[model samples]
Target chain A: MNTDPTRLSAAELAHAIASKELSSVEVVQAHLDRIAAVDADVHAFLHVDGAGALDAARAVDERRASGEDLHVLAGVPIAVKDVMATKGLPTTCGSKILEGWIPPYDATLVSRLKAAGMPILGKTNMDEFAMGSSTEHSAYGPTHNPWDLTRIPGGSGGGSSAVVAAYEAPLAIGTDTGGSIRQPASVTGTVGVKPTYGGVSRYGLVALASSLDQAGPCTRTVLDAALLHSVIGGHDPMDSTSINAPVPSVVEAARRADVKGLKVGVIKELGGEGYQAGVRARFDESVTLLQEAGAEVVEVSCPSFDYALAAYYLILPSEASSNLAKFDAMRYGLRVLPEGIEDPSAEQVMAATRDAGFGDEVKRRIILGTYALSSGYYDAYYGQAQKVRRLIANDFSTAFEQVDVLVSPTAPTTAFKLGDKLDDPMSMYLQDVATIPANLAGVPGMSLPSGLADEDGLPTGIQILAPATQDERLYNVGAALEKMLVDRWGGPLLAKAPQLTAKGA
Target chain B: MPPEHARGRFVVREAPRLAPMSALSRDDVAHLAGLARIDLSDAELDRMVGELGVILESVAKVQEVAADEIEPMSHPLPLTNVTRPDEVRPSLGAEAALAAAPEKEQQRFSVPRILDED
Candidate 1:
């Protein structure tokens, strides 16, 4: 057996623990040690709950020793994005407003993870309120890309992807509103999936854009994501938007790993012009590989996709404005008194506290949202964006009629320098262009490492989009492509990544 | 009442026309920040004016095709009101509910004065 547990996938770790060849405590401790060794440089985690994780691992070991059946992913340690509410663990959403605040209850998904006996490593960092493209927006500071220390590991789920890429955790949970999961996964050379909207319960996920937010698995391999997804994806009456139907058989589809006779569409609008040369080359190579693997490939055009980024900005800020209004000084977060006021009013306190607590990006969006949803502008901005939303959904429906799944480069380019786009919001918004269309249309999308770019030698991801409720197709196609790509590279793409040396060594 | 298909749907009677968009001014941004209950500093306000102007100009493109007879999608899935039996169930107690409150008094969240003294 491999002595280093961090190098193993979550599936491998689970098998080792279940067979009694390794104890859950040992596996969890190994990851904790790995975190201690590399995380100072990586900065992937906002908090590391080492004691709680070890206790949970012990419980799993005891249950297994008593000959009790366990979930497939039981005993595996995982990191969670800070946006999910985990009781007793501080969840900051990478913003100072909620700093030091511990959630009173676990999110439904977190509760599910517990029920399945998975030990949570801790909360990972993200962009403030999941707002920016680079993790640089995190109030705690940015997570460096493990591939290249100076570059970003895409946002806002940068921490989740970085942990997996750096081998700090086998699996992690990430929320995607507009490419938060996939974009980071693309840049970090990992696998990320955004389950069909309503597929995963949103019950304790701090709302970003409610309509677009969906929590899913981030892992190093497609099958590992599948295993984690099945545990967390299901109907939750607590979330009204949760689908009443059973989860798609993603695990089964991933194991099948068959793409024969499947129809794959290369979205016409998602590539060209703004895309990097290496990204396009890698995407084209993946398409050819899919065709050779017995999947029929065709070019499908969705013209409304050109407006996806525009509509997303309007729709997100509008929804976010309403959702974030609850962060007034009175409850559950920071409070500040107006300067030079003897008896400040509630409104004044709220204004001052919000100004002090929120970072610039969060403030920017809230004000933008307030402006969009305001009278006179609502009809032109928010309403118009909602209409464009329908057009994008229609485009998906039209494209789905021609093919089983849509494919594209997950991001326009590989991860840029950490502070390169920090001051420019528009350029940062462009990172999510390809991934946003899936969220708008209520579809499931997966991003898997296609290959390292020829120019920068950084990872590039090929996105696979399946129509709503047909999320299994994404796994089937994704696993097949992942296998072919890995065989060509002679190993996982992460293996090609430069290794990180211990901080003090 | 309109038919099921027409309900909650917006119909544009006129041909789709682009809405005129003017760049957001500093005063406009300041007003927006006020509406949002965030007291932006003068420097922040100055920077936001230029940033918001660029973002607003880009997002305004949505108005181009929006004049068509398209129903606005507020949510991805068609969700009806989800309800359960009107029965008592275990929920968070007051102790736990107020656990995260910035300030609390007598098991209730404390807030700054909402009304002026008479």
Candidate 2:
């Protein structure tokens, strides 16, 4: 195996597998090798299904050899977040409670990815219960940003983005409860999209805040992202809330690369405060490039954005606290008996199970959630937050009235060093401030790398937000910016990544 | 850790302790933890008290708007009947499901004895 592995892109990988130029086995082996060599240092994958992935890849190769028709994603390797349940693949949600528990069934999205013939690359690390913006809260160790090990990769989808950026996989799936996908993509210099809330089914995805959670595609290129989005974005009878609207042709939009006559709204809030200088410079330059490409840019303001973080905290934890209630010792997950209490009472057993299984951050959120949803405070807190959530949604609705789409810096800065702020949960929560509004509003948002952070010299991104059903606008604009940036930068961001000492590639 | 003096309407309202804040004093958090069936070390409880206080304060901004007339919006998107039909669907059979359980007696998953005599 070459120390500097030059693997195929999504299209190339798919074509090679289909045409028999590259057997699925070889493609799967390359990635498994990549994981073995460097993933120890990157810590991107929570679990690597070496044998299972190869066996599945081999099945794809055999089918193609038998002259069977190929699925668009046949033989592709996609990493799943640990938050998404996969049959028998320790879906721990980065917490010790679910550490050794292997879910008996696959999540809805997992089944979709599997049916598409994508080899499950294994579960990637994420924030415990998708609660934190950085994966540091993972009961497992944090995933280091591929750009610089010292910096974080962004979370809770940081591990997913890192695998793609590090070339351990060509495409991955991430859940964007509140910018989990987009924020990490910004820092890691990859493509991440949070489809309209109903665009992707959430049946199997471990819930953080159901209203805010939606799984989207993360890939190295816009076309690739669009392709994966099309496959995973659709209605499901299982999830009645899934939109019945037809999934628009995002791949065609990427292929068209036509930005003419599109009105892109520049959200005034996300531009300056806490934005790194390089990020702003790049964002401005990209806007100019889009303007030059025949797209009109307009300044749009959403004042409710200032309060989005507050609303998100209340809603997410309240929802999470409830959603996670199923993991009692009575159901699945850890069940412990107290140390000294012989034949402990049920209450003691419950306390022991919880004390041993739950982590600090998880406990903290549950407490906060219980308090928010508690009776006397319900109207003042939970009820009020829901009202504010509506106001935030109203802000988006109003903004979309004047413009086709909205744009802003995806994150304040590029990926920070792992452990830089792990001890500080408040600082960690603040990282998702820029990306959470869309989740509250149920809007579709995509993040594509704009420029390197001048301060840290790592990738940062700008987010594209479009109206609920009008997700096509994101593709129209994202593809345009992606094409422009790649042409200037010479290639994808991961192309410049140096070989790692551990995972050679 | 959060500032003790940082207590505000936002903090108190958003993450109010269990009980009326009167039912349990320093033990509200502990009792809440117990109710939720999650164990909390002294350090974790201490941290949560301070964190919850500050968060509740920050979340106070939600009340600034006049919501007396506003209806609670459960979802951002408009909703009608979002629930699926209660139609019969194929489910796993006993053999398929019990085949993988860590420990199973008969058809049901047999976990360790969880309850003590009430």
Candidate 3:
């Protein structure tokens, strides 16, 4: 009890609350206080539900006092990405159009988290409509990286990863369309999982790319992510696309933390040349660590991965254009009238509202997507991208036959400076090169801190991908590598991050 | 546009650069905006044409390998048509459904006039 409970992992906090070493209220308050102290500098949360969180925490304490059996991670507090719908809390998806919209019903994952007795802390910031890599495109403002305020935390789930990295929250939910969760986790030195595409229910998740968006865990420790994953990853009748099978035993796999005799494949196409030198160095070191841990490491190539990023851009924007069509002014969210028009038509209003609401990136994507899905271009753009998608999935199917899991650098480099690649869309898209293939193929991927890069002293992440439904393998390998890295570094990677001081605190 | 300019700032070593596709034009962008129901200013259209041109040129690499024999994959799951029993269930009330509407009239979303008729 003497230690700051905010710094403890979710598992540790749950143990403390269950054993009466601390009340849920105390633990929740500690996190709330931490959020208040550091959030000014971090800007991770779009909204902090202090009162609602306290009430939920108190309910957990009451349940414990009444001797009612609770879920394993009960009383643990979590931050949710704004992309997921929250019943009472404002869910903006980082766009001005839905700035004040409060969803009337909870996302299935949010409902699951609440049922597990995890207090909903608040909605964290993200890129507009979960679109950008650096969270700079968020209509509200950019979320500053805690490691270096000038740098990005990575996005569109930057706030979720940043909250965990800044120790303001033990767990957060992030949706990964194209490495939104994993890349942010990579840059911020946290753990993120993009569950097998259909592994987690997508009900209530604001769609960016319907076929690609899968909400998953963002946490500081591999075990915590596993626990949160267990809570949120189950079949839901509400989501037709949800996997009907039982959630993979990722928690047990994380607990096992053994990869001895496992076949680990290094994707030949994912690395070399384009990767930053320091990132490559760290990845190579992690491979050696895995080899020493008794994993049989071999090189496996996915030749079709060459077209992955290209296919992804086409597929994502095409789906996003259709999915985002729901935001027409006739429905919920923003609506604006064209100026100087005494009688603004509905079409004009919709156009004016969209023009005012969407950022440059969102507009760019929508336009590109519309063009891709348009009559003449449909066969050439969207159709071709889908075919490439099949090839990418085929490559994964082939790779899994030779190896149990595949590993690569999570991203091409560590977090670049905010605004560095903002002007260049292609440069920004390249940041997600390694992580995109998994989403394209619907495979589960986890990114954990490898170590800090020598050049910038920024954290580099090693990504582990398991074939669809083999998600447990990722947890097993990730936990094993995490344990080894922690032992070598003498602590977790986030321990080395420069502490954030509240401005004028 | 040259191949390098079309690829923009980032270079993908593995992706074989294909012939640059038609450069996206302002009129094309405006037409796309109209289709998507997004109003864009002249500057936005100008900027977007250039940006989309680069993106389109780069993404055209997908056509290099996406042969006709390969089938398209729209969804990862094999789930075909997931239909539940048609029995009606409780859903959001009218007030709740329209809670976030920018303009509402008596629990229904009010919108700008569409038809010319009264």
TM-score rank, highest first? 1, 3, 2
Give each prediction's DockQ, rounded to 2 decimals: 0.50, 0.34, 0.49
Ordered by DockQ, highest first, the candidates read 1, 3, 2
Q: How do the residues B15-89 of candidate 3 rate in per-residue lDDT, one tens digit apiece?
A: 343434565667888988998999999989878878888899989888666256778988776767888888989
TM-score of each: 0.97, 0.92, 0.96
The lDDT leader among the candidates is 1
Task: TM-score chain B for all models.
Answer: 0.77, 0.60, 0.75
Model 2 chain A: lowest-lDDT 10 consecutive positions:
A1-10
Q: How close is candidate 1 to the true structure, as a TM-score?
A: 0.97
How much lDDT does each candidate structure score? 0.92, 0.82, 0.91
Ranking by lDDT: 1, 3, 2
Instruction: Give the runs in model 2 whose Cα sits over 4 Å from its true position.
Output: A1-6, A502-505, B1-25, B82-87, B95-106, B109-118
Residue A100, model 2: Cα distance from true site in angstroms: 1.7
lDDT of 2 by residue, A220-329 (tens): 88888988998888888778678987887788888887889988899887778777798899889889989999998999988768778888888888998898887766
lDDT by residue for model 3 (A1-505), tens = 3389988999899899899998989988988898988998889999999999999999999999999999999999999999999998999999999989999999999999999999999999999999989999999999988889899999999999999999999999999999999999999999999999988889999999988999999999999999999999989999988998999999999999999999999999897988999899999999999999999999998888888999999999999998988888777888888888888889889899999989999998998899889887788889989988888888899999999999999989998998999999999999899999999989999999999999999989999999999999999999999999999999989989998885443
